[model samples]
Target: MDHRGGQVEGGTPDGESLPALLRSWRRRTNPRGIPGLATPGRRAEGLTQRDVARLTGVSERWYGALERGIEAEYSADFLDRLSSALQLSPAERRALYLKAVGRLPTLVLPPEAGMPEDVDEGLLQRFLDNQVPAPAFATDLAWNVIGHNEPLLEWFPWVTRQENQMRWVFLEPEAHEQLVNWEQDWARPFLGQLRYERARHPKNEALMRLERDILASSPAAREMWNRREVVEHSHGALRRLRLQCRRGQEVAVRIVALRPMRSDLLRVIVLMEDQRECGGA
Candidate 1:
């Protein structure tokens, strides 16, 4: 579906380029972020080529060659080790493997070309106004909370902090504690959305930093990243959120999303009462 200023030509989105995707991944996975042993003279927090080699029990020269995007023979064992050493989420690991072997999806931009800023703002406002009974907000392509109505902002104070959604989902302790089922309710889908974005715009520097921060802050996010699951945000998906409200009562709400007309931005996320389900007191 023409999400993100790109078209779906020949069964794929326009501007779907593999090199771009690889560059994006590289930007995100810094030397210190990967989990493994470290020694003196290491200048960065992200894993170095040597570190990856150590973790995978391979030579540093070979790993360096791989990182340079040079053509080389790689076994499944080598790929698995590299994936682990890099702490690549399942989606990331797969994308790396595909790109390394010259197998990646082709992106196609829509015939209309691109989405305008005004259109994004208009659609977001419309959704917030129309879905008054529910809490709603619009997030940018990078999952940064860009705008939201009063109700949503009230419940999620972090939204006001301008924190990236993925960071809050995985790094923030409060967020983790408040979410009903952190893994199923948030992490899984959140990572999926990140994967989709990465696939589309792999070279986005902001996106890369967000991923790095999440990895450094939360081991849970790191573990999940290694899983490499590719997922797209599904419309109409609902999740129950239990929050301690201002009225001193625990409230249970269902979260739903309203996507914009021509952008990847999720214009609004409505949180409403679940009359049939009982959890909050």
Candidate 2:
């Protein structure tokens, strides 16, 4: 199985087919292999074909045909069930399905040895320097404020109190009242990004701790987490935030994210508003 570049059409030098791989996987996932099932089966040691069929709601004969590669047409949904039955990781699942159809590609991540703890202060300063009129700050991949210019700190002092962005937004009462369109605008994407990150890096201790603290500290945060929405932070995404000034006037600010490098640790956010939009505040 030539597993290079997601192309898997012609068999390897040994003529190994995807069905061969499936069969091997099938042999490993018996009922006992799964966490809670009874292991009273007679012949096979691992999950029988019947166990997988029952768990995935597919006909035993149909699943058998699938395992045997006798069926040519297989839906992604069916492959998904098979993937779950085999307890394949997300990458493994994708690779298996792709191979089954003779395509070759796989996702690989860089080693996590040198990830930065926070965005660089110099980078944040440079970003803020370039955006003199706009407020800008650099945050970590998890949206924790790492560095912000005086202007941003002056405007959003609450950023200083909480390290986590979502925590500050939902836990702080002032954020709900100050941020216009809180639910429809920021909360949805913020929560979604958190969930997405959690799935991608389930073993991240900092992320897990942040989630636990937020869930315990704020009901709104818990509710949002329960919704299980997932999203990625995209560059140039437009966000609107309403800020209340000390003089009791409202200002509408447009927020944009700036990535100085491909690394997720540094994200500089710029806030801009038209002079007219500034109003009395």
Candidate 3:
């Protein structure tokens, strides 16, 4: 029984209950690792509810109530504090938010974010190559073009030279002439996606560096970045491009962004001709 004479839920191996999981996590944390935490005269192993409450800036009773899965709607900030106090992993933090708030947190990126899984390089290259006439390329989380088909390299040779798609789009002078309606069709949306990715992986060094380079080098990029627009992806979006293959004629392409099951962090982008527009012409 707790101090309130209520029965404390003991965790099971399955640990489906919120209270049980919280208690289990609390017990697993090492007291010695936590800086300035007092361990003397402690009855239970790991951190006590009082310790967690103090760390999270809440009363012991309130923290206890949260652990008990009380039906109060917890704010995102409170849950964030609680997650930090418990030293929850990304997956664990997501689980805590889902259990407490009936949804995922806005800022919680999965553990796989920015980290690409190992895959057969030959197979991945073959997959891009199979796209044939369409421009197909694969990018890591930081928009670094890791792999591209012949068509992609032919159409946007800058990818081979620049390595990073974001850098080429935001910083390259040639991009303005190549991308039709550079400001509206490309820059704005691309900036939005970049902002979204940066928000997701705030600690990513390459992304931060790219952001600094673009904002510092290009006044247009600096202006667009400050617009505060955010986009997750450009999938199914119709984008126009002025390709040298077409003698500088503008062509409309439909963006198809796919995440391979084996490597969720690798984005496979294929620019397929917009059949609806093509058929109309």
Which candidate ranks first by TM-score, i.e. highest? 3
Count of clashes, each model: 27, 9, 0
What is the per-residue lDDT of model 1 for residues 1-281, given as tens digits with 9 covering 90 to 100?
Answer: 22321222234443443334434544455665544543457666444455667878889887666655466556756775665555554345546656565442121111121222445344456768677756776665666555567777677788755445677778778776667777976797788777777777687655677777877888888888888887776456556555645543445566665665665533356677666664434
Q: What TM-score does each of the candidates earn?
A: 0.53, 0.52, 0.58
Over 4 Å off, model 3: 1-115, 279-281
Error (Å) of candidate 1 at residue 271 is 2.3
Report the lDDT tens digits of candidate 2 across residue range 81-196: 67767766334554665666544222111113113534344544676777766677766555666566777877787865565566788778888877777876778778887787
| Model 3, C-alpha of 82: deviation from truth (Å) | 40
The candidate, 2 or 3, that scores higher on lDDT is 3
Better of 1 and 2 by lDDT: 2
Q: In what order do the candidates fall by lDDT, top score first?
A: 3, 2, 1
Alpha-carbon lDDT, every model: 0.59, 0.63, 0.77
RMSD of each candidate? 15.5, 16.2, 15.5
lDDT by residue (tens digit), candidate 3, 114-141 = 6453655577789999999898998778
- Model 2: number of backbone collisions: 9
Error of 2 at 53 (Å): 56
